[model samples]
Target: MPLRDLLLGLFVIAIWALNIIVIKVGVEELPPLLITTIRFMLVAALLVPFYPVARAQLPFLLLLSVTFGSLHFALLFIGLEHAEAGTGALLVQMGTPFATLLAVVFFKERLGPKRIVGLLLSFAGIAVIAGGPTLPSPLPLTILLLSALGWAISQLLIKRGPPIAPLALAGWVALFAVPQVALGSWLFESGQWQAIKQASWVGWGAIIYTAVMSSIVAYGIWYTLLRRHPINRVIPMTLLTPVFAVGLGALLMGDSLGIHKLIGGGLVVSGIALIVIKFRRAPRLA
Candidate 1:
């Protein structure tokens, strides 16, 4: 990657990292699901005008909307309601291993020694977090893990689809996701009307940041880098997200870091690095 691309990559990672903390702040006032709904509504309104017509791909797009956009965010924001932003960021790393396993089972992709080791190391970190004395609620963690699986499933679904414009896909997915999230919020959550009425400028700012910076700008930069370079070279930059999130959480949210989190987070990032780097270096199958 060029220096410029590397810098852009870092910028996206920072946005995504700070996004976790922003969500923590936003959900503190508005309901998480309502925040998600409004965020997607704003993005969808902005990009739906530019969304390419993909009538043939609408079904897959809807599935992507549900799995990736709605269910994923629904579980994630709900989990973030209770879990620390730093810990939630670490747990979301499970998406990589989940995607790997899905590939192994569904696409018959081989899991070489490094991937197998990576898988174990990743889960080992989870075990550490789970066994720690100061562990957060298991239910929230479980929901977050399921959110990761939903994200992995969305990746697999996207892999099966015809190539589509990144922003268009994001837009259409957001268009479809708005209703799912809105309906979910209406059914399961309360105080939506009250939240909107009482929401402060800071809370709304968080939503706007997530909608604009995190969703549109970050994804645009990410796909641009993928277009310019091999994915392996670009993918590793994401490892910085959790690191930034942990630091930002402590600095901004006063989140504590215990021994278990430090050790476990290290192992998780290291394991993900092993998987991504080793796979990038390995010979392509067939």
Candidate 2:
């Protein structure tokens, strides 16, 4: 990456890093699923107007919508409701290794010793997190990890499918996700209307920030950088997200990170470093 694009990539990473904190605030005011539904709805409203559909990719596109946009965000928001923003950021990077493992299993991709070590370090970090005092409970961590797995599966699908325009696909994914997420919210989450009606500016602002900044603007910048540079060069910049997440959570939200978090977060970042450094990388979570 050139200095300019590298700086642009860093800009996107900063936006994404702060997005976890935004989601944490949003979930506090609205039902998690309902908030997800609204976020996608807002994204769809903005993007579908300009992007044309790729009819050939509809099936896979819908799959991406459900797995990446719907299930990923739904579980993520729910997990964040119980978990801190900083911890959610660290744990979600597990998706890269999860996707690598899935590739080994289903696509016959090879994982060398270093990647295996990375996997162990990553999971061990999660275990340490489970043992730590920061999280509300083990259940929220499990939900967050499951969300990571869903993200991995989505990346696998995208890897297998033929190429499509990133923005068009993103718009379609948001459009398709609205219904799936809205249906899930309608079925499992209550007070959707009340939450929307009663929500303050902070709640609505968080939704707009996530929908516009996190999803549309950040992804647009990311795809632009990917086009301008090698994937490996651009990918490593994402590691900063957790760093920003942990820092912002501590500074703004007063979320405590004890010694265990430092140890565990270090292990997770080290593992991710190993994976991105030595091997084929996965597409990042949106």
Candidate 3:
């Protein structure tokens, strides 16, 4: 990769890492589902004018929207609401392994030895993180794991589906997610409207940052890298996100630097490194 592209990738990682802090901040003032809904609404409204869609894509688009936009964010934000930001960031890394497992089982993709080892390492790390005796609450761990699975499924769907511009796909998903989130807020958080109306400027800033930097700019740059470079090179950069998140969480949220985080984060990073190293050494077929 060129220095410029590498820098862009690093920038994306920074935005995503800080996004965990943004979520932590946003959820303090606004309900998770409501904040998520507002963010997606803004993203959808911004992208709709640039990327017009046809009626034929509605079904798949709706599915993508619900899975990626509504379900993913709803579960994630709620999980973050309960879990420590650092721990939540670490647990969400499971999505990569979960997506790999789905690809192997459903799509007949081969999980080579390194990939298998990576999956096991990641799972073991998650288990250690979740089962750590000092964890404040078990429910947050459970919710975050489910959130990771939801995101993994969404990734698999995106990989299997017809090719679409990343922004267009994101826009359609956001547009479809609005109703679901609104309904969820209504059913579960009836009084949230008043809360949202009284949200502070910090909360609004967090939402805007998530929608514009994390969603639009990060994803846009990521898709650009995907198109320009091999997946092996681009995907490994994502491992840095949680690292940044953990650091930022400690600095910003005063989250403790526990032994479990150090050990688990090490395993996760090492596992991903092993896979990338091995994959790079493998011979290519004609």
Candidate 4:
């Protein structure tokens, strides 16, 4: 990759990392489901004008919306409500291995030895993180794991199915998601209306940052890179996102650095490195 593309990818990673902080902040003022609903609403509004979707594609787009937008965010926010930001960041990295497994099972994609090794390293890292003394709650860990699975499923669906422009797909997904999240918030949160009314400027700013910078701008850049580069090269950049999140959580949220985190992070980074190295040497599968 060119230095420019690498920097752009890093920028995307940074935006996504900052998003965890934003979510933590936003949830302090608003209920998780409501915050998610508003974020997707903003995303939908921003993209709808520029990327109009055909009615024929509505069903597929709706599935994407439900899977990626509603289900993923719903579980993530609920998990974050109970889990520490740094641990939540680390746990979500499991999505990569889960996506790889899904590809092998559903799409008949073969995993090389390095990929298998990477998967094991990642799982070991997750086990270490989970077994650590600092885990907030067992329920939160379970929710985070399920959130990771949802993300993996969404990625596999995107990979195996119709080729939609990334922004367009995102827009349609957000559009479909607005209703589900809105309904969920209404059904689950009795105080949601009061919370929305009382939320401060800082809280609203966090929502805007998540919807615009994190979702729209960051994903737009990522999709651009993915369109131009090979998936192997582009996807590996995601490994840096949790690192950034962990650093930001420590700096901003007063999250502690611990032995388990250090060891698990090292293993996770090494696993992703192994996968990238293996992909660089192997021929592309037809």
TM-score top scorer: 1
lDDT order, best first, reads: 1, 2, 3, 4
Relative to the true structure, how large is the alpha-carbon lDDT of every model?
0.89, 0.88, 0.85, 0.84
The sequence of per-residue lDDT tens digits that candidate 1 reaches over residues 117-218 is 988899998888777654569898888999999988988888888788888988899899999999999999998999899999989999999999999999
Q: In model 1, which runs have C-alpha deviations exceeding 4 angstroms?
A: 279-286
Structure candidate 2, residue pairs in collision: none
Pairs clashing in candidate 3? 65-173
TM-score of 2: 0.94
Residue runs of model 4 more than 4 Å from their true location after superposition: 276-278, 282-286
Per-residue accuracy of model 4 over 1-286 as CA lDDT, tens digit each: 9999999999999999988888888888888989998988898898988998777888888888777887688889878887778788888777778888888898898998889999889888877776677566888888888888889989888877687888888877888899998998888887887898999998899899998998889988998998899888888788888899989999999887788887887787777666655343577899
TM-score of 4: 0.93
Across 1-286, the per-residue lDDT of candidate 2 in tens digits comes to 5688878988899899889999999999999989998898898888888987767879888989989987688899999999889999988989998998999999999888898898899888877876788866779888898899999999999888879777787788988998898888899999988999999999999999999999889999998888777888888888889988999999999988888788888898888888887455698999
Evaluation by lDDT, superior candidate among 1 and 2: 1
Put the candidates in TM-score order, highest first. Answer: 1, 2, 3, 4
Off by over 4 Å in 3: 133-136, 275-278, 282-286
Provide the lDDT at 10 for model 2: 83
Whose TM-score is higher: candidate 1's or candidate 2's?
Answer: 1
Residue pairs in collision within model 1? none
As a whole number from 0 to 100, the lDDT of residue 70 in candidate 2 is: 76
